[model samples]
Target: MPKFLIQATYTAEGTQGLLEEGASGRRAAVEQVVSGLGGTVEAMYFAFGEYDIVLIVDLPDASAMAAAGLAVKASGALHTRATPLLTLDEADEAARRQVRFRAPGAQGPAGA
Candidate 1:
C-alpha cells in the first residue's frame, strides 16, 4: 500500500454546502468514500488558506488512487492535488541508485 497527501480547495458551491452540513459531516463523508474504495483515511483536517482540506490516505495501489482523484474531481465540489508520500527507506534506496548523466563541460553519458 502507498500513502498520499491530498490538499483540496473547495469551490464556491462546495463551500456553501459545507457551511450547511458542518465539518463533521464532511469528515464522515470523506471517510466513507475512502473506505469504500479499499482505502483508509489516516487523518483529515480543515485549513484556512490556499487549501480548505488536508487528507492523509493509504490506498491499495496507483489505480485506486487515480479512481479516488477522478471521483472527487468529477463531483465538482473540490479541486485537489495529490502528492505521493515516500518513506525514509525509499528515499535512501533512491539515493543509492546509480544514474547516468552529463554535467556542464562534460561530453555526454560517456566522455566523447
Candidate 2:
C-alpha cells in the first residue's frame, strides 16, 4: 500500500459545517470515505492557520488517492492537496539509484 499526506483548508461554508458537526464527526466522515476506497486513515489532526485539517492515510494506490481528492474537492466545502508519502527506506532506495545529469548551460558532459 502507498501512503498520502492530505492537507485541507475549509471554506466559510465548510467551517460552518465543521462547527456544527465537530472535529470528531468530520474525522469519522473522512474515515468512512477512505475505507470505502480501500484505504485506512492512519492519523488525522484538526489545526488552525493555513490549514484546518491534515490526514495521513494508506491507500491501495495513487489512483485511490486521486479519487478521494476529486470527490472531496467536488463537494465544494473545502480545498484539498494530496501528496504521496515515502517511507525512510523508500527514500534511501531512491537516494541510492544511479543517475547522471548536467545542469543547463554547464558546458559538455556532466563530469567534463
TM-score on alpha carbons, each prediction? 0.89, 0.92
**Residues 78-103 of candidate 2: C-alpha lDDT, one tens digit per residue:** 99988999999999998888767778
83, model 2: CA deviation in Å?
A: 1.3
Q: Supply the global lDDT for candidate 1.
A: 0.91
Error of 2 at 43 (Å): 0.4
RMSD of each: 2.7, 1.8
- Scanning candidate 2 in windows of ten residues, the lowest lDDT window is 103-112
Local accuracy of candidate 1 as per-residue lDDT tens digits, 1-112: 7999999999999999999999999999998888888999999999989999999999988788899899989999999999999899999998888888789897777432
* Candidate 2: residue 66 Cα off by (Å): 0.4
Task: For residue 102, give model 2's deviation from the true position in Å.
Answer: 2.7
Candidate 1 clashing pairs, residues 3+ apart or interchain: none
| Sliding window of 10 residues with minimal summed lDDT for model 1 | 103-112
Runs of candidate 2 exceeding 4 Å displacement: 108-112
